[model samples]
Target: MYYGGYYGGVGGTWFLILMPALLLAMYAQLKVTSSFNKYLRVQSGSGYTGSEVARIILDRNGLHDVRIEQVGGNLTDHYDPRSKVIRLSRNVYNGHSVAAVSVAAHEVGHAIQHDEGYFPLILRNNIAPIASIGSRFVWILILLGLVISPFLIEVGILLYVAVVLFQVITLPVEFNASKRALYQLENGIVYRDELDSSKEVLNAAALTYVAATLVALGQLLRLLSIFGRRRD
Candidate 1:
């Protein structure tokens, strides 16, 4: 999830502070899109569809009960810890492309994290609802506080802190998942020569998470600065 919103007309130094992160976010989005599209057309040597690769990895890890389902949309693959199911986008589920398998394996990596009680994933899931609420209403509260009460602004800042925390926690989870995906793919599914391409896809994807964290952090700092100056 990306954290971003306008801070009314209040501008200057804080805006400058946020500029770099905003630019990085844009670059990250372009990088992931380009990498995914580029590799999506390049089929893996193993000829295993994304669903097939996910199934193999799941079963090998003794997660035979874990199920894989095809979902609609582009690059929407994810693992549902509650249902023990891996949901893949149509292309990733049926295509034999490097991008497809790499994405599929990355999602399976989440399932493995769930099974082993990975701390960051566990924490992330636990606070997901709070983070969701924070992301949805933080700006509203802050804007209202600007027009109404300092208390509301303080409350908004506190809520956004949760959103920022969630973004921070997500980094390790994604990085580890990509690492796991590389290991699984390298074993046999993806060719030796194709591994670098696979890494590119995963790394490009990881950059998005990094960008998100930076954006959240920058916004948090901006909020604090705004509040501080308001009191002055």
Candidate 2:
């Protein structure tokens, strides 16, 4: 998750800096949801279920050891690098719709990236633990600094820098996965006419990541502004 701290008492001008990013994040969520649902109702011409498409792509890439499993929740699909597993939501794993295959293939794209040690993906994985900690504790530290010690605010800012770095690093990883996914679908699974719709689905999903990065960046700017003003 590319989440950042919510500075509740910040000046209104600082809030203004974050508002546009928040709006984009909301729009991105709606776009992806609408695109996915609309295409989920439209069956793919190949008629292969999402799981089958995943298997085909994985085998073609010589990732025979990677496994697919069904998980609960809508749009909860992901590829776990540590476990070497691709988890799909029930609808994605069983559905034979255009959206289903597109998402399934996208997760397989991540698997292929992991197998080939894509630099961005590798860097993201390496820093994920620290970034996770930063996102979780950053606000707490900031709030405590306001009441206890200004030094804690500096520490909080350092932690938030890590969170922002993670979000920035994620952009390339996601965009590359979508690129790989589109290529795989165009080769055989998706029909020529259906390729555009598949691209729409993937593009909508990609917007969410872009929006997240923006939100993280906006929040970072707010934090820095406040810290600098306090010092002055």
Candidate 3:
């Protein structure tokens, strides 16, 4: 595995395993997302724009307090937890394709989560600042540990703890988003049959999160393994 054999003192085996796994997940997400976007227009007979669809879903949920605004980029839609707003990218906000509706519905799902107090979402919000703090300094800290201290293990431990915590928090936030997206779709909050491609769009987008989490996890494991062998 790490065959580093105390080369850096840690197996780094986790990286050996993780890098390919990370690539595999990314490939799956990329293919799924691209294909869904490509084929969705064919099934999108609804002709309803993303902004219109967002309005419908929001009003249905009595979420008038939340506003939808158009932003730039492809598939860059997201719910702004801080401002309680939904920002839909150009494609997601205006297109009548399945990709549009599915992404729009998924963003609204976050507003619903905000309203209902989904525990994981709430916990994720609370941890945001803490995680941000760690991520911002993680690389510097890890590198500093390696170069500055004979007690490198302790420094590495700190870095690993921060990284792992960030990864752990990320998992639930994504899983909940996908759950809410599927729930909204199946509940007839958004009529996929009208476009018949909404499900695929949401499914594809969810895979992005899955890819991200797995990649983070693998990297964390590799870091841990690397530091873990320091005493050897």
Alpha-carbon TM-score of each model against the true structure? 0.92, 0.93, 0.82
Q: What tens-digit string does per-residue lDDT give for candidate 3 at 23-139? A: 878787787768666855653555677777788878888999899999987767889978989999988787776677777777888888888888867877876666666656666
Give Cα-based local distance difference scores for all models: 0.89, 0.90, 0.69
**How well does model 1 score by local distance difference test?**
0.89
Better of 2 and 3 by TM-score: 2
lDDT of 1 by residue, 48-154 (tens): 99999999999888999999999999878899999999999999999999999999999999999999999999999988988898889988987887888778878
Tens-digit per-residue lDDT, 92-152, candidate 2:
9999999999999999999999999999999999889888988999889888877787778
Ranking by TM-score: 2, 1, 3
Best by TM-score: 2
Sort the predicted structures by lDDT, highest score first.
2, 1, 3
Candidate No. with top lDDT: 2
Measured with C-alpha atoms, the lDDT of residue 191 in candidate 1 is 91
What TM value does model 2 have? 0.93
Residues forming the 10-long window of minimal summed lDDT in candidate 1? 1-10
Give residue 64's error in model 1 in angstroms: 1.4
For residue 30, what is the lDDT in candidate 2? 100
